[model samples]
Target: MSTQKRTVLITGCSDGGLGAALARAFKDAGFFVYATARNPAKMQSLAALDIETLQLDVQSQESVNSCAARIKQLDVLVNNAGGQFVMPLSDVDIEAAKKIYDLNVWSQIRVIQAFLPLLIASKGMIVNNTSIASVAAVPFQSIYNSSKAAIASVSETLRLEVEPFGVKVIDLRTGVVKSNLINNLKETQHPKLPDGSIYEFAKDTVEKALRQDGFEGQGLDQAVWAKAIVGDLMKKNPPALIWRGESAWLSRIASILPHGLLDGTLKKLVGLDIVEKAIKEGRH
Candidate 1:
């Protein structure tokens, strides 16, 4: 029997993001933190803290398999590597949407399967970081919503399957957080997002919405959120779903509403209603 403290490996833990915050929180809770990112250079600050840093790109099976192979044991696996792009479902490039799903959905499946042996050995927990939008699907974020919803579903199935093996599975219904999400938005240049004729009404508003969700983020605090998640990870019997954050309440509310009502509510909230009205009035 090994007497070493539990080890936690979190993906996409570059600096200035929630994954990094989670690594710090887990370390504070006395766990060995292996914080990984596609580009290890981005995690130099975390490495400076003596946290193990690896270049693990969930998008690449070779990267995931190699990282998993290096670890003899893992107590917690946090699937936090995900990305998104905002655009109308109509205008979104299918290829771009597929890429988001590959990162958010398939990537998680790949990592979890690769780490299953270690998890089964330790009877450890797996936390798949999903979004509130999973069940609270809103417009213009269809691709993101769909990908996260798939996570929620697959996590539930994973929980059932792994329970007999004594492995706990958690779908962390993450709310909007303060992190590089805003930076990601700023770093990317999307011509259609701001000035496309079809997107004129909502693009700027959507940009504001994403920035607000990441900054003001409705009072989202990364440190606080990470603390909550780490606490759950340490529990002897954690919930199947650890749901919290700025949008958690709204997500719950959205779930109770009818599809039509929910869609209408989201349109108004994100300025999609204005765009719809313009289209109805035949205005360019």
Candidate 2:
């Protein structure tokens, strides 16, 4: 046992998502946990667990700073809150796209920056809850995937930058796990495509894809991933990138395939024929 009882702070801990699972696992592993979300009431169930729930709106500087001030030390910080918006690039409102990025990427950055001093003080670690989408570039989910992709790159850079300061940065590439992200996706639909838009065909495909309750692939088990993540965090030497869950290996394969192959696969899966025909015919 590492003698030192570390503290872990996780964000976006709804009742049964990855964050909540992490909170429970870390607590069971003998770490003090600060579990946070936009609404503390949503986390009422967590109150019964061995953890402290706090209010944290990652996009708000005031909220991030305030929480950072209250924590005297931190052994691990997990940026686990993020979700997808159901809007094609052509129909995507600029404000909505920005909203997705703000929560998925910038919010994680803000939380990490605000707590850097404390993490360093404890010579701790950071576990960025990134996704296979980070590298796979899924169609109809460009914004969400891209935002996570940005975080993965950021995690890589930060690992090196902060290593000399005695803090380890780990990027966790998670595959689909049973969570509320699918159920809570925000839908942004424009009845008519924007004039001269290039993505009119993508609109319908995007809608259908978003409506589908993501296939809980045999690999997408929440409890299993949670256990694996906890095991890594408790290791004597943790890996820089922890890849697990149903789609983890598959997405990694997608990331390395040639662009043509990747695009063709995505097209077939997302009903590209409908969108492509719409594009050629200029039908909004």
The number of the candidate with the highest TM-score is 1
Tens-digit lDDT track of model 1 for 187-214? 6724245345466655666656544343
Give candidate 2 regions above 4 Å deviation: 1-4, 186-205, 213-219, 277-284
TM-score of each model, in listed order: 0.90, 0.88
Over 162-205, each residue of candidate 2 has an lDDT whose tens digit, in order, gives: 99999999999998788766556533332234555566446556
Candidate 2 matches the true fold with a TM-score of 0.88
Best by lDDT: 1
| Cα RMSD, model 2 | 3.3
Model 1 segments more than 4 A misplaced: 1-3, 189-218, 280-282
Error of 1 at 220 (Å): 1.2
